[model samples]
Target: MTADSLPPWLRQPLAELLRQRGHAWLLQGPSGLGQYELGLALAAAWLCEQPEEAKAQGACGHCPSCHAIQVRTHADLCVLMPEVAMQALGWPLDEKSQADIDDKKRKPSREIRVEAMRDAIGFAQRTSARGRGKAVLIYPAERMNNITANALLKTLEEPVGEVRFVLASEAAWQLLPTIRSRCLGFTLPWPDSGQAQDWLVGQGVPAADAPGLLRAAGGRPSDALRLASQGQSPKAWSLLPKAMSRGEVGALSEHAPAQAIGALQKLCHDLMAVDCGALPRFFEPADLPPAPPRAALARWSRSLASAAKTAEHPFNAGLMLEALVSEARTTLNSASRRP
Candidate 1:
C-alpha cells in the first residue's frame, strides 16, 4: 500500500524516515504498531523512480518500482521473512523452497532460515537490477535464529554495492546486540486514543465498536482493525470476561490455543488492575466480574504465562481451552466467596 493510505499516525513518521539517510535501519516497537508498513514505505521510497521532489512525499504511487513492490515482484527489492509470513503477505518464495513445501518434503518454516539469509546476502552483493539501488526488507527480524542472524551480520555491517537494509521487529530486545549496534533504530510511535479510534472507524469498523476494539487492543490501531477483520464484535469481547468467569468453554472454543491464552491473560490483567485500585485496560469495569484475590490472580497470571510458551504446539487444543477456562472460573470466583 502507498504511504498515502497508511494510517494517519504513520504519515509523519514515514515522511520523517524518508528524509533520513541510513544504509541500514531497524524499525522496532511492540506488535500492531505498523513496523512492517513503515519499513516497506521507507524501502519503496528508496527504490522509487520518482523525481526527488515527488519522492519526498514518499513513493510516487505510479512508478514502475512502486508497482513492482505492490505486486511483490520487484527485482531490486529482496524481502526476508519466514516462508509462512511470505506466503501470507503475498510474496513469492524462491522456486526451490516453494517446490519443497509443495512437494510435502518440508513444512513452511516459522523462523527465518539460514539458507534464506545466505540467498539475501548474495542478493546484496549483486548489481542493482532496476538501475536504482536494491533493498532488503526483513520483517519480524527477531525471528532470525542465532545462525541466521550471524549469516546476515557481515552483510549488514559492511554492505556491498548500493544496497540498503530495513529490519522491522515487534521485539527488538530479542535481536543480537551486534545486529542492534549496526543499524539506525527507530521506534514506531503509538497513536493517540482519538487517532486510533478514528482510524479504526475509517478502516470499516463500526463507529460504535471502535472504542471497545481499540481498548481491547490496548490502543494499537492495527490490532483493533485486525480484531474487526476477524469478525470479533465489540460486544463479544465485552462479554468474554464474564463468560470465562462462568466457566464457559464455548466463549473461547473458536480461538486458537495461543489466542485463547492471550484473551485470558488480558482478563487476568484487568482483574489485577481493578484489585490494585486502577481502571481495567481491556474491559469496562462494569463488564468485568468482581476482582479476584490478589494472590489467586497472581497465580493465574503465572499459569497463563506458562501456557503461552507452549500454546503454539499444544498436544490437545480442546483440553487446553477447558483447563484454562476452568482455572479462570476458579480464580474469578475466589473474591465472591471471601468471608
Candidate 2:
C-alpha cells in the first residue's frame, strides 16, 4: 500500500517538511514499516505538474502522473530496488516459465549495484520531464556498497540540476556516516498497542480478540492489520498467552525470534502499566497474568530491557530467549506461591 493511504502516525515527517521547505530527504524506519512507500509518495509529490501548492499539498491522486507514479510506472521518477540478475545466468523468471531459483532462498542483492546507481544518477543529471522537478528514489540506501555509495555521494554532494534524492532504509545505521549526515531523516513511531488493536479490528480481525493480535504483531498497526487480513493472526494470538505463561527457554529459541519477542514485549508493557496503576486497559484485568513478585518483576524487567537493547547481536538470540523464559517461569512460580 502507498504511504499516503497509511494512517497519519505511519507517514514520514520529512515528507511534510519537504513540502513546506522544498528539500530532499532520507527516510528511515523499521523493516516492513513502509519506508519505501514513503519514498515513493515523496517522489510523486515532487514530480506532479499541478501548482506547486497542489503538488505539495498532496499527490492529487487524480493527476495522470500521480496515478502512474503511484503505480510505479512514471517515466521521470526512478526507483531502484535490489537487482535480481537472472539474465547473467541463462535463466530468468517469467510468468509462463518455471525456474529452479528458490524464491524462498532469494536474498536482496548485496548492494543496489553500481550500474543501477549510475543510471539513476545520470537520469537526475538531465532536465525534468515536465520542466519542473526530477526525483530519484533508492531503496535500502544502506545496501549500496562502498563503490555504489561513493558514486551516489558525488552526485548528492554536487547535483547539476533541480534534482532530489529520496532514499529509504530499514537499517539506516548501516549507511556511511557522511551520507547519513547529509540527509534529513524522519523517525516514524510505531503506533501504540491500543491504536494498533483498533486498526486490526477495522481490518476485520474479530472484535473479541484484536488486542491479543496487536500484542503478537509488536504494536505495529500495519503488522497487526496484515495478519488479521490474512486470517493468520488468531492462531498466533492463541499461542501467545500460553507462551507467556509456559513456553520455556527451549521452545522460545525454536519459535521465531520476532514472534517470541513480540509477545514478551507486550507482557512487559502490560506489567509496566499495571505497576504504574494505568487505567482503561487493553488486556482484560481478569485474564491478565499477574506481574512478577515486586522485586523479581523489577529485576526481570531490567534484564529483558537489556537483552532487547542487545537483540541485534549474533550471540544475543539464545541468551535473550533463555532470559525471557527464565523470567516467565519466575513470574509464574511466584504467582502460584502467593496467597
| Candidate 2: Cα lDDT at 105 | 47
Model 2 clash pairs?
none
Candidate 2: tens digits of C-alpha lDDT, residues 1-339: 234565665555534654554345778877656676567777777777677755444566777777776455676777766644223222222322223234544443545768767887888888777766788878878778888888888788777788887888888999898788778777766666666666667667788767765645555566666656545545445554455677456545544455555556666666667767874133444445666566666766676666665464436667667767777776756756655
- Each candidate's TM vs. the true structure? 0.96, 0.63
lDDT string for model 1 (167-208, tens) is 999999999999999999999999999888888878788999
Q: Quote model 2's TM-score.
A: 0.63
* C-alpha lDDT (0 to 100) for residue 327 of candidate 2: 70
> With candidate 1 superimposed using the best TM-score fit, by how many Å does residue 238's alpha carbon deviate from the native?
0.8
Model 2 misplacement above 4 A: 1-4, 10-15, 31-33, 83-111, 190-195, 229-231, 241-339
lDDT of each: 0.91, 0.64
Q: Which candidate leads the pack in TM-score?
A: 1
